[model samples]
Target: MSLDTSTRGFGWRAVQFLTVLVYVFMFAPILVVIVLSFNASQFGGFPMTGFSLHWYAKLLENESVLRAFQTSLWVAIVTSIVCTALGILAAVALVRYEFPGKEWVNTILIAPALVPETVLGVGLLLLMRFAHQPRTMWLLVLGHIMLALPYVVLVVQARLIGVKRVYEEAAMSLGANRLQTFREITLPLIMPAIVASLLLVFTISFDNVTASMFWRPSGVETMPTEILSMLKISISPEINALGTLMIVVTVGLPLLGGGLARYLARSAR
Candidate 1:
Protein backbone atom coordinates (compact mmCIF):
# COMPACT_ATOMS: atom_id res chain seq x y z
CA MET A 1 0.00 0.00 0.00
CA SER A 2 2.83 2.39 0.82
CA LEU A 3 4.56 1.62 -2.49
CA ASP A 4 1.38 2.22 -4.48
CA THR A 5 0.77 5.52 -2.63
CA SER A 6 4.35 6.66 -3.28
CA THR A 7 4.07 5.81 -6.97
CA ARG A 8 0.78 7.76 -7.21
CA GLY A 9 2.39 10.71 -5.43
CA PHE A 10 5.27 10.70 -7.85
CA GLY A 11 2.90 10.55 -10.83
CA TRP A 12 0.89 13.49 -9.56
CA ARG A 13 4.06 15.53 -8.99
CA ALA A 14 5.29 14.70 -12.48
CA VAL A 15 2.00 15.81 -14.04
CA GLN A 16 1.92 19.02 -12.03
CA PHE A 17 5.47 19.90 -12.91
CA LEU A 18 4.85 19.12 -16.60
CA THR A 19 1.78 21.33 -16.63
CA VAL A 20 3.71 24.20 -15.06
CA LEU A 21 6.58 23.76 -17.47
CA VAL A 22 4.31 23.67 -20.52
CA TYR A 23 2.49 26.84 -19.46
CA VAL A 24 5.75 28.63 -18.80
CA PHE A 25 7.02 27.61 -22.19
CA MET A 26 3.89 28.88 -23.87
CA PHE A 27 3.32 32.09 -21.93
CA ALA A 28 6.79 33.27 -20.96
CA PRO A 29 7.30 35.33 -24.12
CA ILE A 30 3.85 36.83 -23.93
CA LEU A 31 4.38 37.75 -20.29
CA VAL A 32 7.63 39.49 -21.18
CA VAL A 33 6.00 41.46 -24.02
CA ILE A 34 3.11 42.52 -21.81
CA VAL A 35 5.44 43.69 -19.07
CA LEU A 36 7.77 45.51 -21.46
CA SER A 37 4.99 47.26 -23.34
CA PHE A 38 4.46 49.52 -20.37
CA ASN A 39 8.13 50.31 -19.95
CA ALA A 40 8.89 54.02 -20.56
CA SER A 41 12.12 53.34 -22.39
CA GLN A 42 12.00 54.39 -26.05
CA PHE A 43 13.43 51.01 -26.79
CA GLY A 44 11.73 47.93 -25.36
CA GLY A 45 13.93 46.28 -22.69
CA PHE A 46 14.72 45.62 -19.06
CA PRO A 47 15.45 48.07 -16.21
CA MET A 48 12.45 50.21 -17.06
CA THR A 49 12.67 53.94 -16.51
CA GLY A 50 8.91 54.47 -16.05
CA PHE A 51 5.54 53.18 -17.16
CA SER A 52 3.56 55.08 -19.79
CA LEU A 53 1.11 54.59 -22.63
CA HIS A 54 3.05 56.89 -24.92
CA TRP A 55 3.92 54.20 -27.41
CA TYR A 56 0.34 52.98 -27.72
CA ALA A 57 -0.80 56.58 -28.31
CA LYS A 58 1.82 56.93 -31.02
CA LEU A 59 0.74 53.61 -32.48
CA LEU A 60 -2.72 55.07 -32.85
CA GLU A 61 -1.28 57.92 -34.90
CA ASN A 62 1.04 55.83 -37.07
CA GLU A 63 -0.51 55.82 -40.52
CA SER A 64 1.78 53.16 -41.94
CA VAL A 65 1.08 50.71 -39.13
CA LEU A 66 -2.64 51.39 -39.39
CA ARG A 67 -2.59 50.74 -43.14
CA ALA A 68 -0.65 47.55 -42.70
CA PHE A 69 -3.11 46.41 -40.00
CA GLN A 70 -6.05 47.10 -42.27
CA THR A 71 -4.42 45.23 -45.12
CA SER A 72 -3.76 42.22 -42.90
CA LEU A 73 -7.31 42.20 -41.52
CA TRP A 74 -8.95 42.19 -44.94
CA VAL A 75 -6.63 39.56 -46.32
CA ALA A 76 -7.05 37.29 -43.31
CA ILE A 77 -10.82 37.69 -43.32
CA VAL A 78 -11.20 36.98 -47.03
CA THR A 79 -8.69 34.16 -46.92
CA SER A 80 -10.49 32.48 -44.02
CA ILE A 81 -13.89 32.53 -45.73
CA VAL A 82 -12.63 31.37 -49.12
CA CYS A 83 -10.28 28.73 -47.82
CA THR A 84 -12.68 27.40 -45.19
CA ALA A 85 -15.47 26.97 -47.71
CA LEU A 86 -13.20 25.28 -50.20
CA GLY A 87 -11.80 23.10 -47.47
CA ILE A 88 -15.25 22.04 -46.28
CA LEU A 89 -16.26 21.02 -49.77
CA ALA A 90 -13.10 19.06 -50.40
CA ALA A 91 -13.25 17.44 -46.97
CA VAL A 92 -16.87 16.45 -47.43
CA ALA A 93 -16.19 14.99 -50.84
CA LEU A 94 -13.25 13.00 -49.63
CA VAL A 95 -14.97 11.77 -46.49
CA ARG A 96 -18.53 11.15 -47.70
CA TYR A 97 -17.85 9.80 -51.15
CA GLU A 98 -15.47 7.59 -53.04
CA PHE A 99 -14.04 8.33 -56.47
CA PRO A 100 -11.03 7.66 -58.64
CA GLY A 101 -7.68 8.48 -57.07
CA LYS A 102 -9.38 9.40 -53.83
CA GLU A 103 -6.26 8.87 -51.76
CA TRP A 104 -4.15 10.73 -54.31
CA VAL A 105 -6.62 13.59 -54.39
CA ASN A 106 -6.64 13.84 -50.61
CA THR A 107 -2.84 13.81 -50.53
CA ILE A 108 -2.71 16.65 -53.01
CA LEU A 109 -5.21 18.65 -50.98
CA ILE A 110 -2.97 18.23 -47.94
CA ALA A 111 0.22 19.14 -49.80
CA PRO A 112 0.53 22.65 -48.48
CA ALA A 113 0.51 21.48 -44.87
CA LEU A 114 4.07 20.14 -45.11
CA VAL A 115 5.46 22.37 -47.85
CA PRO A 116 7.87 25.03 -46.59
CA GLU A 117 6.24 28.46 -46.66
CA THR A 118 9.23 30.07 -48.41
CA VAL A 119 9.26 27.56 -51.22
CA LEU A 120 5.52 27.74 -51.63
CA GLY A 121 5.60 31.51 -51.61
CA VAL A 122 8.32 31.71 -54.24
CA GLY A 123 6.67 29.10 -56.44
CA LEU A 124 3.30 30.83 -56.18
CA LEU A 125 4.82 34.20 -56.99
CA LEU A 126 6.54 32.78 -60.06
CA LEU A 127 3.36 30.99 -61.14
CA MET A 128 1.36 34.19 -60.84
CA ARG A 129 3.91 36.14 -62.88
CA PHE A 130 3.90 33.50 -65.59
CA ALA A 131 0.11 33.77 -65.75
CA HIS A 132 0.54 37.52 -66.32
CA GLN A 133 -1.20 38.32 -63.08
CA PRO A 134 -0.79 41.67 -61.40
CA ARG A 135 0.30 41.83 -57.79
CA THR A 136 -2.99 42.65 -56.10
CA MET A 137 -5.20 41.94 -53.11
CA TRP A 138 -6.66 38.97 -54.93
CA LEU A 139 -3.24 37.40 -55.37
CA LEU A 140 -2.51 37.78 -51.69
CA VAL A 141 -5.89 36.29 -50.93
CA LEU A 142 -5.10 33.31 -53.13
CA GLY A 143 -1.74 32.80 -51.50
CA HIS A 144 -3.27 32.85 -48.03
CA ILE A 145 -5.99 30.46 -49.13
CA MET A 146 -3.37 28.07 -50.43
CA LEU A 147 -1.53 28.29 -47.15
CA ALA A 148 -4.66 27.89 -45.00
CA LEU A 149 -6.66 25.32 -46.95
CA PRO A 150 -4.77 22.25 -45.86
CA TYR A 151 -5.31 23.01 -42.20
CA VAL A 152 -8.97 23.84 -42.67
CA VAL A 153 -9.55 20.64 -44.60
CA LEU A 154 -7.75 18.54 -42.00
CA VAL A 155 -9.74 19.99 -39.09
CA VAL A 156 -13.10 19.65 -40.80
CA GLN A 157 -12.27 16.19 -42.10
CA ALA A 158 -11.41 14.89 -38.63
CA ARG A 159 -14.66 16.27 -37.25
CA LEU A 160 -16.62 14.82 -40.15
CA ILE A 161 -15.24 11.35 -39.52
CA GLY A 162 -16.00 11.53 -35.80
CA VAL A 163 -19.61 12.74 -36.26
CA LYS A 164 -20.93 9.23 -36.93
CA ARG A 165 -22.80 9.31 -40.24
CA VAL A 166 -25.59 7.32 -38.61
CA TYR A 167 -27.22 10.57 -37.67
CA GLU A 168 -27.02 11.83 -41.26
CA GLU A 169 -28.25 8.49 -42.50
CA ALA A 170 -31.32 8.74 -40.26
CA ALA A 171 -32.05 12.18 -41.68
CA MET A 172 -31.89 10.80 -45.21
CA SER A 173 -34.14 7.86 -44.39
CA LEU A 174 -36.75 10.34 -43.22
CA GLY A 175 -37.30 11.39 -46.86
CA ALA A 176 -34.73 14.16 -46.99
CA ASN A 177 -32.82 14.51 -50.26
CA ARG A 178 -29.03 14.27 -50.19
CA LEU A 179 -28.59 17.99 -50.39
CA GLN A 180 -31.23 18.75 -47.79
CA THR A 181 -29.95 16.07 -45.48
CA PHE A 182 -26.43 17.40 -45.67
CA ARG A 183 -27.56 20.99 -45.25
CA GLU A 184 -29.74 20.30 -42.21
CA ILE A 185 -27.85 17.53 -40.45
CA THR A 186 -24.22 17.20 -41.38
CA LEU A 187 -23.43 20.89 -41.58
CA PRO A 188 -24.92 21.78 -38.24
CA LEU A 189 -23.21 18.87 -36.53
CA ILE A 190 -19.76 19.91 -37.70
CA MET A 191 -20.32 23.67 -37.50
CA PRO A 192 -18.07 23.88 -34.43
CA ALA A 193 -15.12 22.44 -36.30
CA ILE A 194 -15.85 24.74 -39.24
CA VAL A 195 -15.83 27.80 -37.02
CA ALA A 196 -12.69 26.62 -35.23
CA SER A 197 -11.01 25.96 -38.56
CA LEU A 198 -11.94 29.43 -39.84
CA LEU A 199 -10.61 31.19 -36.75
CA LEU A 200 -7.41 29.13 -36.79
CA VAL A 201 -6.76 29.75 -40.48
CA PHE A 202 -7.53 33.44 -40.14
CA THR A 203 -5.04 33.68 -37.29
CA ILE A 204 -2.48 31.76 -39.31
CA SER A 205 -2.92 34.05 -42.29
CA PHE A 206 -2.93 37.12 -40.06
CA ASP A 207 0.32 36.14 -38.38
CA ASN A 208 2.15 34.56 -41.33
CA VAL A 209 5.29 36.49 -42.29
CA THR A 210 7.56 34.66 -44.67
CA ALA A 211 4.90 33.70 -47.24
CA SER A 212 2.97 36.94 -47.10
CA MET A 213 6.23 38.87 -47.20
CA PHE A 214 6.95 37.52 -50.66
CA TRP A 215 3.44 38.10 -51.99
CA ARG A 216 2.68 41.49 -50.45
CA PRO A 217 3.04 44.50 -52.71
CA SER A 218 6.32 46.34 -52.26
CA GLY A 219 4.80 49.48 -50.76
CA VAL A 220 1.79 47.76 -49.17
CA GLU A 221 2.08 45.70 -45.98
CA THR A 222 0.34 43.45 -43.51
CA MET A 223 0.89 43.46 -39.75
CA PRO A 224 3.44 40.68 -39.93
CA THR A 225 5.09 42.32 -42.93
CA GLU A 226 5.19 45.63 -41.06
CA ILE A 227 6.78 43.93 -38.06
CA LEU A 228 9.41 42.53 -40.39
CA SER A 229 10.08 45.96 -41.85
CA MET A 230 10.33 47.48 -38.37
CA LEU A 231 12.87 44.82 -37.41
CA LYS A 232 15.13 46.12 -40.18
CA ILE A 233 15.23 49.49 -38.38
CA SER A 234 15.27 48.87 -34.60
CA ILE A 235 13.00 47.80 -31.81
CA SER A 236 10.67 50.41 -30.37
CA PRO A 237 8.11 50.54 -27.57
CA GLU A 238 5.41 51.00 -30.18
CA ILE A 239 6.28 47.57 -31.50
CA ASN A 240 5.94 46.18 -28.02
CA ALA A 241 2.52 47.81 -27.72
CA LEU A 242 1.51 46.22 -30.99
CA GLY A 243 2.80 42.89 -29.78
CA THR A 244 0.85 43.23 -26.53
CA LEU A 245 -2.31 44.07 -28.45
CA MET A 246 -1.89 41.02 -30.67
CA ILE A 247 -1.29 38.76 -27.70
CA VAL A 248 -4.50 39.96 -26.06
CA VAL A 249 -6.42 39.57 -29.30
CA THR A 250 -5.06 36.14 -30.05
CA VAL A 251 -5.94 34.93 -26.58
CA GLY A 252 -9.35 36.59 -26.59
CA LEU A 253 -10.55 35.25 -29.93
CA PRO A 254 -10.37 31.55 -29.11
CA LEU A 255 -11.84 31.98 -25.65
CA LEU A 256 -14.70 34.18 -26.92
CA GLY A 257 -15.40 32.14 -30.03
CA GLY A 258 -15.11 28.81 -28.30
CA GLY A 259 -17.54 29.90 -25.59
CA LEU A 260 -20.04 31.21 -28.11
CA ALA A 261 -19.78 28.06 -30.19
CA ARG A 262 -20.31 25.88 -27.16
CA TYR A 263 -23.34 27.91 -26.14
CA LEU A 264 -24.86 27.51 -29.57
CA ALA A 265 -24.04 23.83 -29.73
CA ARG A 266 -25.71 23.18 -26.39
CA SER A 267 -28.72 25.29 -27.34
CA ALA A 268 -29.02 23.34 -30.58
CA ARG A 269 -28.98 20.03 -28.75
Candidate 2:
Protein backbone atom coordinates (compact mmCIF):
# COMPACT_ATOMS: atom_id res chain seq x y z
CA MET A 1 0.00 0.00 0.00
CA SER A 2 1.07 3.57 -0.67
CA LEU A 3 2.00 5.75 2.32
CA ASP A 4 -1.21 7.84 1.90
CA THR A 5 -3.36 4.71 1.68
CA SER A 6 -1.78 3.34 4.90
CA THR A 7 -2.41 6.62 6.71
CA ARG A 8 -6.09 6.68 5.64
CA GLY A 9 -6.61 3.05 6.78
CA PHE A 10 -5.19 3.82 10.26
CA GLY A 11 -7.34 6.95 10.56
CA TRP A 12 -10.50 5.03 9.63
CA ARG A 13 -9.68 2.31 12.16
CA ALA A 14 -9.12 4.90 14.90
CA VAL A 15 -12.51 6.52 14.15
CA GLN A 16 -14.27 3.16 14.32
CA PHE A 17 -12.62 2.33 17.65
CA LEU A 18 -13.61 5.71 19.12
CA THR A 19 -17.20 5.34 17.89
CA VAL A 20 -17.56 1.93 19.58
CA LEU A 21 -15.97 3.26 22.76
CA VAL A 22 -18.41 6.19 22.86
CA TYR A 23 -21.45 3.92 22.49
CA VAL A 24 -20.16 1.56 25.21
CA PHE A 25 -19.52 4.45 27.54
CA MET A 26 -23.00 5.81 27.00
CA PHE A 27 -24.88 2.52 27.36
CA ALA A 28 -22.76 0.55 29.85
CA PRO A 29 -24.47 2.00 32.95
CA ILE A 30 -27.94 1.28 31.54
CA LEU A 31 -26.87 -2.30 30.73
CA VAL A 32 -25.49 -2.70 34.25
CA VAL A 33 -28.75 -1.45 35.80
CA ILE A 34 -30.74 -3.91 33.69
CA VAL A 35 -28.48 -6.80 34.69
CA LEU A 36 -28.54 -5.89 38.38
CA SER A 37 -32.32 -5.57 38.43
CA PHE A 38 -32.42 -9.37 38.15
CA ASN A 39 -29.82 -9.92 40.90
CA ALA A 40 -31.10 -12.11 43.73
CA SER A 41 -28.80 -10.54 46.30
CA GLN A 42 -30.35 -8.22 48.86
CA PHE A 43 -27.92 -5.46 47.98
CA GLY A 44 -27.36 -4.01 44.52
CA GLY A 45 -23.70 -4.59 43.58
CA PHE A 46 -21.01 -6.59 41.82
CA PRO A 47 -20.89 -10.32 40.97
CA MET A 48 -23.87 -12.20 39.49
CA THR A 49 -25.04 -13.46 42.91
CA GLY A 50 -27.57 -15.59 41.06
CA PHE A 51 -30.59 -14.32 39.10
CA SER A 52 -34.27 -13.99 39.96
CA LEU A 53 -37.39 -11.96 39.30
CA HIS A 54 -37.86 -11.25 43.02
CA TRP A 55 -37.37 -7.54 42.61
CA TYR A 56 -40.00 -7.28 39.91
CA ALA A 57 -42.40 -9.36 41.99
CA LYS A 58 -41.76 -7.06 44.93
CA LEU A 59 -42.67 -4.11 42.71
CA LEU A 60 -46.15 -5.59 42.27
CA GLU A 61 -46.55 -5.89 46.06
CA ASN A 62 -45.45 -2.34 46.81
CA GLU A 63 -48.54 -0.17 47.03
CA SER A 64 -46.61 3.11 46.93
CA VAL A 65 -44.84 2.16 43.72
CA LEU A 66 -48.09 0.97 42.14
CA ARG A 67 -49.91 4.15 43.06
CA ALA A 68 -47.05 6.31 41.84
CA PHE A 69 -46.95 4.39 38.59
CA GLN A 70 -50.66 4.99 38.07
CA THR A 71 -50.21 8.69 38.75
CA SER A 72 -47.35 8.91 36.25
CA LEU A 73 -49.38 7.05 33.65
CA TRP A 74 -52.32 9.38 34.07
CA VAL A 75 -50.15 12.50 33.80
CA ALA A 76 -48.40 11.17 30.71
CA ILE A 77 -51.67 10.33 28.99
CA VAL A 78 -53.22 13.72 29.66
CA THR A 79 -50.07 15.62 28.71
CA SER A 80 -49.62 13.68 25.47
CA ILE A 81 -53.22 14.16 24.36
CA VAL A 82 -53.24 17.87 25.11
CA CYS A 83 -49.84 18.47 23.58
CA THR A 84 -50.71 16.54 20.43
CA ALA A 85 -53.91 18.50 19.87
CA LEU A 86 -52.37 21.90 20.55
CA GLY A 87 -49.16 21.01 18.72
CA ILE A 88 -51.01 20.13 15.53
CA LEU A 89 -52.82 23.43 15.50
CA ALA A 90 -49.71 25.44 16.35
CA ALA A 91 -47.57 23.61 13.81
CA VAL A 92 -50.14 24.07 11.05
CA ALA A 93 -50.47 27.74 11.78
CA LEU A 94 -46.73 28.28 11.92
CA VAL A 95 -46.06 26.38 8.73
CA ARG A 96 -49.05 27.32 6.60
CA TYR A 97 -49.77 30.90 7.51
CA GLU A 98 -48.02 34.28 7.31
CA PHE A 99 -48.91 36.26 10.38
CA PRO A 100 -47.19 39.07 12.33
CA GLY A 101 -44.62 38.03 14.95
CA LYS A 102 -44.80 34.46 13.69
CA GLU A 103 -41.18 33.83 14.46
CA TRP A 104 -41.63 35.23 17.98
CA VAL A 105 -44.64 33.03 18.51
CA ASN A 106 -42.68 29.99 17.37
CA THR A 107 -39.86 30.91 19.72
CA ILE A 108 -42.24 31.36 22.65
CA LEU A 109 -43.90 28.01 21.95
CA ILE A 110 -40.61 26.11 22.06
CA ALA A 111 -39.00 28.14 24.86
CA PRO A 112 -40.05 25.73 27.60
CA ALA A 113 -37.85 22.98 26.21
CA LEU A 114 -34.95 25.39 25.77
CA VAL A 115 -35.13 26.70 29.33
CA PRO A 116 -33.60 24.75 32.21
CA GLU A 117 -36.06 22.54 34.01
CA THR A 118 -35.16 24.10 37.36
CA VAL A 119 -35.86 27.55 36.03
CA LEU A 120 -39.08 26.45 34.40
CA GLY A 121 -40.17 24.72 37.60
CA VAL A 122 -39.42 27.71 39.79
CA GLY A 123 -41.13 30.05 37.38
CA LEU A 124 -44.26 27.98 37.28
CA LEU A 125 -44.29 27.67 41.05
CA LEU A 126 -44.02 31.40 41.46
CA LEU A 127 -46.71 31.93 38.86
CA MET A 128 -49.03 29.60 40.72
CA ARG A 129 -48.38 31.39 43.98
CA PHE A 130 -49.02 34.77 42.40
CA ALA A 131 -52.29 33.59 40.87
CA HIS A 132 -53.41 31.92 44.14
CA GLN A 133 -53.58 28.58 42.38
CA PRO A 134 -53.03 25.46 44.46
CA ARG A 135 -50.44 22.90 43.48
CA THR A 136 -52.20 19.75 42.24
CA MET A 137 -52.23 16.97 39.67
CA TRP A 138 -53.66 19.41 37.17
CA LEU A 139 -50.63 21.63 37.73
CA LEU A 140 -48.36 18.64 37.17
CA VAL A 141 -50.22 17.82 33.97
CA LEU A 142 -49.84 21.39 32.78
CA GLY A 143 -46.11 21.40 33.47
CA HIS A 144 -45.62 18.20 31.52
CA ILE A 145 -47.64 19.52 28.61
CA MET A 146 -45.40 22.59 28.46
CA LEU A 147 -42.28 20.44 28.49
CA ALA A 148 -43.61 18.02 25.86
CA LEU A 149 -45.34 20.46 23.51
CA PRO A 150 -42.19 21.69 21.79
CA TYR A 151 -41.22 18.21 20.69
CA VAL A 152 -44.66 17.51 19.26
CA VAL A 153 -44.76 20.83 17.43
CA LEU A 154 -41.30 20.32 15.95
CA VAL A 155 -42.12 16.79 14.77
CA VAL A 156 -45.48 17.72 13.24
CA GLN A 157 -44.05 20.87 11.72
CA ALA A 158 -41.34 18.95 9.93
CA ARG A 159 -43.90 16.58 8.43
CA LEU A 160 -46.11 19.47 7.42
CA ILE A 161 -43.23 21.26 5.71
CA GLY A 162 -42.45 18.21 3.59
CA VAL A 163 -46.07 18.14 2.39
CA LYS A 164 -46.90 20.17 -0.72
CA ARG A 165 -49.42 22.98 -0.60
CA VAL A 166 -50.51 21.92 -4.09
CA TYR A 167 -52.17 18.82 -2.64
CA GLU A 168 -54.46 20.98 -0.52
CA GLU A 169 -55.11 23.29 -3.44
CA ALA A 170 -55.96 20.33 -5.64
CA ALA A 171 -58.47 19.05 -3.12
CA MET A 172 -60.00 22.50 -2.85
CA SER A 173 -60.21 22.77 -6.64
CA LEU A 174 -62.31 19.61 -6.61
CA GLY A 175 -64.94 21.49 -4.54
CA ALA A 176 -63.74 20.21 -1.19
CA ASN A 177 -63.95 22.77 1.65
CA ARG A 178 -60.82 23.73 3.63
CA LEU A 179 -61.84 21.51 6.53
CA GLN A 180 -62.56 18.58 4.22
CA THR A 181 -59.21 19.00 2.47
CA PHE A 182 -57.42 18.99 5.81
CA ARG A 183 -59.34 15.98 7.12
CA GLU A 184 -59.11 13.86 3.96
CA ILE A 185 -55.74 14.76 2.45
CA THR A 186 -53.59 16.68 4.92
CA LEU A 187 -54.43 14.69 8.04
CA PRO A 188 -53.49 11.32 6.49
CA LEU A 189 -50.20 12.72 5.32
CA ILE A 190 -49.29 13.79 8.83
CA MET A 191 -50.84 10.92 10.79
CA PRO A 192 -47.44 9.23 11.17
CA ALA A 193 -45.93 12.39 12.60
CA ILE A 194 -48.88 12.82 14.96
CA VAL A 195 -48.61 9.23 16.18
CA ALA A 196 -44.87 9.61 16.72
CA SER A 197 -45.43 12.91 18.55
CA LEU A 198 -47.99 11.29 20.85
CA LEU A 199 -45.58 8.56 21.85
CA LEU A 200 -42.63 10.95 22.14
CA VAL A 201 -44.61 13.35 24.33
CA PHE A 202 -45.88 10.46 26.43
CA THR A 203 -42.33 9.29 27.08
CA ILE A 204 -41.12 12.77 27.99
CA SER A 205 -43.96 13.32 30.46
CA PHE A 206 -43.54 9.86 31.96
CA ASP A 207 -39.86 10.43 32.68
CA ASN A 208 -40.10 14.03 33.88
CA VAL A 209 -38.83 14.64 37.42
CA THR A 210 -37.67 18.21 37.99
CA ALA A 211 -40.92 19.84 36.86
CA SER A 212 -43.01 17.13 38.50
CA MET A 213 -41.34 17.86 41.82
CA PHE A 214 -42.39 21.50 41.58
CA TRP A 215 -45.98 20.96 40.49
CA ARG A 216 -47.07 17.77 42.30
CA PRO A 217 -49.32 18.15 45.36
CA SER A 218 -47.89 18.00 48.87
CA GLY A 219 -48.68 14.31 49.58
CA VAL A 220 -48.99 12.86 46.07
CA GLU A 221 -46.07 11.29 44.23
CA THR A 222 -45.43 10.24 40.67
CA MET A 223 -43.14 7.29 39.87
CA PRO A 224 -40.01 9.38 39.40
CA THR A 225 -40.61 11.31 42.60
CA GLU A 226 -41.40 8.09 44.45
CA ILE A 227 -38.12 6.63 43.22
CA LEU A 228 -36.34 9.77 44.41
CA SER A 229 -37.77 9.23 47.89
CA MET A 230 -36.51 5.66 47.83
CA LEU A 231 -33.02 6.83 46.93
CA LYS A 232 -33.02 9.11 49.96
CA ILE A 233 -33.00 6.01 52.20
CA SER A 234 -30.97 3.43 50.21
CA ILE A 235 -30.32 1.84 46.87
CA SER A 236 -32.40 -1.29 46.61
CA PRO A 237 -32.86 -3.78 43.78
CA GLU A 238 -36.47 -2.62 43.55
CA ILE A 239 -35.20 0.74 42.35
CA ASN A 240 -33.20 -1.04 39.69
CA ALA A 241 -36.28 -2.91 38.61
CA LEU A 242 -38.22 0.30 38.45
CA GLY A 243 -35.44 1.95 36.47
CA THR A 244 -35.44 -1.00 34.08
CA LEU A 245 -39.16 -0.62 33.52
CA MET A 246 -38.66 3.07 32.87
CA ILE A 247 -35.91 2.25 30.39
CA VAL A 248 -38.28 -0.09 28.63
CA VAL A 249 -40.88 2.66 28.52
CA THR A 250 -38.80 5.80 27.64
CA VAL A 251 -36.74 3.82 25.12
CA GLY A 252 -39.35 1.42 23.80
CA LEU A 253 -42.07 3.93 23.00
CA PRO A 254 -39.80 5.98 20.72
CA LEU A 255 -38.57 2.83 18.94
CA LEU A 256 -42.12 1.57 18.50
CA GLY A 257 -43.21 4.99 17.32
CA GLY A 258 -40.37 5.14 14.78
CA GLY A 259 -41.30 1.74 13.40
CA LEU A 260 -44.95 2.66 13.18
CA ALA A 261 -44.08 5.98 11.52
CA ARG A 262 -41.97 4.18 8.93
CA TYR A 263 -44.77 1.73 8.22
CA LEU A 264 -47.26 4.56 7.84
CA ALA A 265 -44.89 6.52 5.60
CA ARG A 266 -44.45 3.56 3.30
CA SER A 267 -48.18 2.88 3.25
CA ALA A 268 -48.88 6.51 2.40
CA ARG A 269 -46.49 6.29 -0.52
Indicate which candidate wins on lDDT. 2
lDDT of residue 111 for candidate 1 = 94
RMSDs, each prediction?
2.5, 2.5
lDDT of 2: 0.92
Q: Which stretches of candidate 1 lie over 4 Å from their true place?
A: 1-5, 8-22
Instruction: List, residue by residue over 164-227, the lDDT tens digit for candidate 1.
Output: 8888889889999999998999888888888898899889989998888889876889998898
Query: Per-model C-alpha lDDT, please?
Result: 0.89, 0.92
- At residue 24, what lDDT does model 2 achieve? 100
Write model 2 residue lDDT over 59-107, tens digit each, in one string.
9999999999999999999999999999999999999999999989999
TM-scores, each model vs. reference? 0.92, 0.95
Please state the error at residue 220 of candidate 1 in Å: 0.9
Model 1 accuracy (lDDT, Cα): 0.89
Using TM-score, give the best candidate's number. 2
Prediction 1 TM-score vs. true: 0.92
